[model samples]
Target: MTAETCENGPLRRFLTVSNKLAALGAIGVSIGFVIVIWVQNNHTRSLLYETELQDSIRMTEVIAAQLYGPLRWRKPSIAQDTYDSMITHRDLHVVAAVTLDRQGNVVTTYQQNSSQPFNFQELRLNAGADLRLDSTWTAELDGKLVVATPVTSHDGRKPAGTFVVAWSLAEIDRAMRAMFLRAAFITIVLFAAFTTLSLAIVHRQLSDPLTQLTQATTRIANGDKTFEIPCTDRRDEVGDMARALVTFRENVALIDRLTAEQQQQTLRLSNALEKEREYNALHREFVSMVSHEFRTPVAIIDGAAQRIERRVGKDTEDQLRERTGKIRSAVVRMIELIDSTLSVSRMEAGTIELEAAECDFAALLREVCQRQQEIAKHHKIDLTIADLPSRILIDAKRMDQVLTNLLSNAVKYAPDAPDIAVKAGTVGRNVVVSVRDRGLGIPEAEMPKLFEKFFRASTSAGIPGTGIGLHLVKHLVELHDGNITVDSTEGKGSTFSVTIPTRYGEADAAASAALSA
Candidate 1:
């Protein structure tokens, strides 16, 4: 509503929502892409395993056929070069034989890792026919593929039992290594190409538009609105989102500007209302204080004036003097209240200074107790005092004010209960003085701010108080380098404790001096 508020441009919209959307899209795509790769890798490995199985089986069949048939079951013989060739074969690592009787065994073995020797014995006895393969054993240092097969010798067309061969697993391991390396290399090359092309596509379709949006948002934050983002013709979600965002930003800026103006108007109204209320409160306090102070004195003056006017008709001269003395007492009480008000004002404005002196605290408490006892008797409130031997150095008048304010507050707050206590003792190198009252106590939550100016108890609404008593007490106590603490429970009672350090503790000062020596 003001010209000053209008000078600031449109309010800015937060664009973090856009970054979040992009991040969500990127995360979803990455997870899907990883799952696809894992499935593809599993399928490739399965295919490789099956291919190796078929190839190994076929090679076993071809190699086994070169051995004996059932007709040569008893005796077997083969040429040395023939045995040597089978032993040194590229794909096969061993050749060996065993009789159907468990004691007969012979082997043309490869010079490598050992094969399981029981195969020929076990296989010849178990199916008793064509044995295409025995088993493979892998080498420890370098994988050497080994297999065994039974062989037979043909002599005059007679039958012989078996011949067996042992072989290494080198070729199988080599093929597996090759397959894995190929898959890894191909996968890496394809992934690099895919990522590079995808990044370039994204740069074309997305990054440029997003960059423009970002710059426009920054300009908006800096209170600029003359520039605009170029709208694209693409009919995708991104294009729709860009259009929506531009519209949203336009609407939000207008609403925010209007809201700012409304806030300014509300602040001005609030300040004006606050000042008016403060003026009313000050006027009300002035009237109440002046009236309370002036009421009794005005009454006494009116009664005295009426008496003096009637003295010529009915009264003796001494009776007239007695009435005049009553008027003087009322005036003195009024003067005391006025002085209390003025002293509080001076304390608040930092115009009051202490007349500090090194006085015995014990002697001061004796005097305070003597004076308070007479007042307590009139109010029917018992005043108990104890532990007054502890001494401290402080301003006598200020210390007296602390005790007086606390006593008055307790009496005022607990008039019906009628019991009040004052206790003082040495706690470490400090003296602790406590005022305890059994009365309507303070709430726990209100205890902390009890010493703050103008704060009153929740239950004390009808009570006559200025709410400055505790505030003045706190300042006076602290001026003597003491701290005051309170503990209270609702409906029970309250205690106010003040602790001030000793001016000279005989034991402590002597210990410190001895240590220095």
Candidate 2:
């Protein structure tokens, strides 16, 4: 079949590919042009409105100045003459002008069209109850611009009366309408020319060659591999596509071989993923068993100590009482360690979340210090709290855990140090709580890995720790949309500071609510 007959056979019943592309291009260009024109029209109208408003105000000021003497001396005849002279100017387009005395009684008035009714009472109400003669006031009402200027005495200290003028806005409206019509006509002409040119170029450069390529591709799709693709010599994208098709036919066997190998690789990956999933299941089971196994004995030890203390009361030796107290303390410490381990596991499994609420932060800090002091009798914890908010939004239980951990670390790491300083205050829009201790400070080289999981500083060699306290601390702080930082000097001391915002943002609050739900 001839090329023209082939193009018209079935494709012409619908829009051809080239025709559709040209039409889409025309639509996009028209939308962009219309948007630009709309913005320009609005900007031009604003400029014109502002220009006319200023000119009206200036003209009213001049009329008020001329009428100052006439109203001051109570010469109604002269005031009428001044008002008439001002309104007679053709460019002013004054619809009605009125001069009123200090008590708002009309002294003299001028109306360009005597047929229209002018309400003096409405004008007085618009001027305001105070008369406000010290400055000018302007308003637009019923397609008219009204300006009221003060006519002051010769000394400019007291006002004698007010000069009010109303101008018609019809001229401005007419000008804007004319501008819109002209722009619409130009847009129509340009759009027609652009569409015609785009169609011509698309049909010449794209439609004919793509038609031949389409026929060749159809033949290959039907298993006619001996058919040749045309447009191979054009030195453009079309020629590249034609050459790529030839290579595709030759590599059919290679592609089939690679696909089979890929299937084998996918099967191997699936088996590895299954093995990893099984390992994770076993890990979770182990954590659950450890939690139940460790808590039972600790609870028994704590209960036995309490029973012995109650039985051996007045006749008990001081040493015996102290020994029982140590047993209970040890039980508490073990429980804390178990909880921390579970917390880390939950975090890794992505099941940990915050239960944020309004908390009394100051009371919470004082309680933490008191509990830490009870455990570490040798080291005194000195708390210095500044003016803090009455209530702060935070996860109170998790925050209590954070403070206890910090205090415990301070007492454990600082063997010889006698005191720990705890401070809480507000900085900018955040709340900052810092715990400082006089201990063997961290090595500077290991500072970068301080918050990494299972990382321990060299200075913590002799100290009893699982090396996950700071890492867990950092993670918990970040969950509250906060951060923890440290400052230390070797052989001196270390200060760990936590900073968090006073409240969560709307998006965070919504997410928290959804998670809770």
Q: Mark the 10 consecutive residues where model 1 has the least summed lDDT.
A: 137-146
User: After superposing candidate 1, which stretches have Cα over 4 Å from the reference?
Assistant: 1-283, 286-290, 293-336, 372-385, 389-391, 504-517
Instruction: Tell me how far candidate 1 lies from the true structure as C-alpha RMSD in angstroms.
Output: 23.3
Off by over 4 Å in 2: 1-320, 505-517
Error of 1 at 296 (Å): 4.8
Q: For every model in order, what is the number of clashing pairs?
A: 31, 0
For residues 1-517, what per-residue lDDT tens digits would candidate 1 score against the true structure?
A: 3112223243322223443445455555555666675676667656754555445544543444444442233223443334445444453434332333223333222233345444544433332345433433222212322333333332223223233333334454566567656666666666556555655566567776766665665666666656665554558866776677677668768987899999999998999999788756855775585675477567887888888887766777788877787677566546545655666688779887766666788777666655555444434334344554444566777777777667767776776777778787777767788888887889988887788765678755555666666777787777666799998877777899988766534455589999999
In candidate 2, how many Å is residue 71 off? 99
lDDT of 2 by residue, 1-517 (tens): 2223354665574488878888788878888888888899999988988888888888888888889889989999998877667667555688877888898888988888889888766766676556665545465567788878888866778788888888777788898888888888878777777777788888767887787777776666555667667878878888888888778766754665688899989999999999788756645654554565466557766675766666676435765767677666667677678778889889889888988889899999999899888878899999999878988888988888899889998998898897799999999778899999999889899999998766668897755566667878898899888999999988898999999887745457689999999
- RMSD per candidate (Å) reads 23.3, 42.1
